[model samples]
Target: MAGRSIEPFREIGGRLALVRKAYGLTQRQLAERVGRPASYIAKLELAERRLDVIDLEELARALDLDPGLLLSRLMGKDPI
Candidate 1:
């Protein structure tokens, strides 16, 4: 899932971790803002669970990132 798929989970997780770090947030903080379990954020960062579109959008918004940017980065396209 990380190295082979078109949406490589490692890349996605890396990007997500980057965004969270850039925002100076912890997994628990991000989870509270997005109303998700902190373990979910940890799982995402670890590439243990795939995030759905709705969850992605919510996370992007919560992190104050453009949803398009999240979509683009996650899809391996140019950042928005």
Candidate 2:
């Protein structure tokens, strides 16, 4: 939420979904890794919610991705 201008969360959500699925993780599975509820991941993926850097870090850790790269992807800079 800081450092960069707020990007459209709908786009971010779609990227997040792509990365999560690429890792072959279910919403529940990714949530377990991030210590969140499946519904939380579901909401984020559906663009019903927003993501902060901390949340992105947790997901990157779970998916073996770099947080910056993930953020870049969300910002429409680089691909995941």
Candidate 3:
């Protein structure tokens, strides 16, 4: 585990879940706020779908996070 670089999708997925949890928001709640499907959120959390910058920004905003911090964390860099 130590030597492995985190995969982009997995990192993003993890960050998504973490931010959602940090805000005490359920997937359904986040999905509703984002105007996306709950299943879509679930798929994103599972890394089953690709995420984009726009979606990243939207998610970060919804969770009251810095977009850059979310992207950096998702890329496995130390969040600034």
Candidate 4:
């Protein structure tokens, strides 16, 4: 799945971790905000998983960021 990925999981993971930390939310707190399990957030931040569109949208809303920015960065495109 990682090899077939369209988004750069490493960069996404790093950014996601940074944004989450910047908001002062733990993995569990973010997951709770998005109605997901804490493990899901942890896996993404650890680069052990990739988020589907819905997950990305929910995460963006939870982090108060635009989903486009996250998707752009994850896909290696300019965040225009």
On residues 1-80, what C-alpha lDDT tens digit does candidate 2 reach at each position?
Answer: 46844446766777788888888889999999988899999998886777877888888888887776656854658854
Quantify all predictions' global Cα lDDT against the true fold. Answer: 0.79, 0.79, 0.80, 0.81
Off by over 4 Å in 4: 5-7, 74-80
For residue 30, what is the lDDT in candidate 3?
A: 97
lDDT of 3 at 37: 89
In model 1, the runs with Cα more than 4 Å from the true position are 1-7, 74-80
Candidate 4: count of backbone clashes, pairs at least 3 residues apart or interchain: 0
Best-performing candidate as measured by lDDT: 4
TM-score of each: 0.78, 0.79, 0.79, 0.79
Q: Output the TM-score of candidate 2.
A: 0.79
Error of 2 at 74 (Å): 4.9
Residue range 1-80, candidate 1, lDDT tens digits:
44666446666777888889888999999999999899999988887888778888889989887766655654668752
TM-score of 4: 0.79
lDDT of 4 by residue, 1-80 (tens): 53675347766777788888888999999999999899999999877887778888899998888887765764668643
Task: List candidate 2 stretches off by more than 4 Å.
Answer: 1-7, 74-76
> Residue-pair clashes per candidate, as listed?
0, 0, 0, 0
Compared with the true structure, what per-residue lDDT tens digits does model 3 show for residues 39-72? Answer: 8889888878777888887887777778877678
Mind sharing the TM-score for model 1? 0.78
Q: What is the C-alpha RMSD of each candidate to the true structure, in Å?
A: 3.1, 3.6, 4.8, 2.8
